[model samples]
Target: MKKYILLIFLAAGITMTISCRKYPVDEKGLLITDNTTCYMSSFNLLGSDNQTVLVTIPTFANGLIDTVKGTVTATAKFGTNITKVKPYCSLGANDMLVDPFMGQWTDFTQPKTFTLISGTRKIKKVYTITVTVQQ
Candidate 1:
């Protein structure tokens, strides 16, 4: 009876170990797992000097991220040249964005849409960014 009980416990332990998906830390002390983050964490607009040209609402938050509605919004400073401003963004560490790349002169006269893909490349979300120039 004792041997049978021990065997059952071992089987349960093995099942639990196999069922769990979270991996342990690796040599670099970083948790090993398939990254699932897929969103724009931050958004900023820069001018020719490569510095932010958007007016801060409270000294921070270059733009607002509305995850529910998948929208990003910001207000550019008065007299800013929105026609040739460049956009900078912070996304998931391993994520990749191409085709209308950042840091290039882009006209923000109208709203722009950006598609962000997860590091795992299994999830994607599109965010529409609208910048209004302050008068």
Candidate 2:
């Protein structure tokens, strides 16, 4: 009986070990192609004024190498009041721009400059810029 029990335990352990094989991580990560559709979730804003900005981040033709485009719309509320807000994008680290590419804002129907505000005032205000890469 002990021999049979030991054999059963050994079989189970070998099965489990084979099933739990570790998958190797790809060296270059997942591949992105022209047919791939990338989706972006909404950004949450926290401050004296509560706001939520949602946008569909555009996908690139070549995944992070090609041009990308998308739209951004923001809604803000202070206390019991609700209002529409406008956001801007800058050409820096927070929102970096690659060379030879152009990013434009088309949702608000205007071209606005990205401004740095004091404290968290600008935190609740968000905008989206459609990016286009050109040769």
Candidate 3:
């Protein structure tokens, strides 16, 4: 009976340790990856009235084998008019890319920034961003 209890205790301890493991973050507090794309989206940005706007940004990778590069592409639709837009990357407080135009995807190689402008005043608005990491 004592041997069985000891084994059960050992298994429980191991399970707890595994479940509580944490990943290491980079200096910027962002998760780090090797040779992989990372995607990040933002919560909807709502306006005063209640009109909703959706924005999406997709990043692409095309280069020589073993070489990786990133490009930002975005589309914004307000109510009904769909507009293709591009946001400029800007430095953020955490050194992360802050592209309001759309979602952002980046590799571990370098940091990026992005900024966007809404053409009109929206009473109610929401933005959806998607980032895809290509391997």
Candidate 4:
């Protein structure tokens, strides 16, 4: 019957179309995959401790980070970054808070978020960065 022939043709067409679909690939020709391991790696106060506190992203996705863990001086500027790997870098809304950079003000306590994006792939990882300080 024509109905049966049309059904078979439709199924073949769908299969061929799906088989030709392509995913974003990296420079190496490997397909890019979703990654959820974005997190803050370290935090430090400028002109002061020079001693850096290591931070971890909780196992839970999009987990909150309590970076200072305690109060810091009013005049503290901070530097921070995520663990480095090729093609991926962290970015923050505030220019000073960008990854691998410094110069953020510590006068008020608030939460900031960083987006981890791949340089050679279309993937994103999001994380929240928070610092606690005394009023």
Ranking of models by lDDT? 1, 4, 3, 2
TM-score of each: 0.67, 0.24, 0.32, 0.31
Q: What lDDT score belongs to each candidate, Candidate 1 first?
A: 0.76, 0.32, 0.33, 0.38
Model 4: pairs clashing at backbone N, Cα or C within 3 Å:
none
- Give candidate 1 regions above 4 Å deviation: 1-33, 57-63, 96-99
Better model by lDDT, 2 or 3?
A: 3
Q: Rank the candidates by TM-score, best first.
A: 1, 3, 4, 2
Residue by residue across 17-114, what tens digits does model 1's lDDT show? 98985766644464545677876777889999878888753112443787657788889999899999988887756544422577889999999988
Q: After superposition, how far is residue 75 of candidate 1 from its true place, in Å?
A: 0.2
RMSD in Å for candidate 3, one decimal? 14.4
Question: Please, what are the lDDT tens digits per residue for candidate 4 over residues 1-135?
Answer: 999999999999999999998767755565554442333443333322333322332222232333333111122223432221111122322111233223443322354444544433343444454443322
lDDT of 2 by residue, 1-135 (tens): 999999999999999999997544323342222222232223222222433333232223223212223333333332312223333323212222222222321232232223222121222122243222121
For residues 1-135, write the lDDT of model 3, one tens digit per residue.
999999999999999999997755655575432222222222222223333332432322221111122233333354422222222222112223333433322221222333321211111122233322232
Assess candidate 2 and give its lDDT.
0.32
Question: Where's the lowest-lDDT run of ten residues in candidate 4?
Answer: 81-90
The number of clashing residue pairs in each candidate reads: 0, 0, 10, 0
Preferred candidate (TM-score higher): 1 or 4:
1
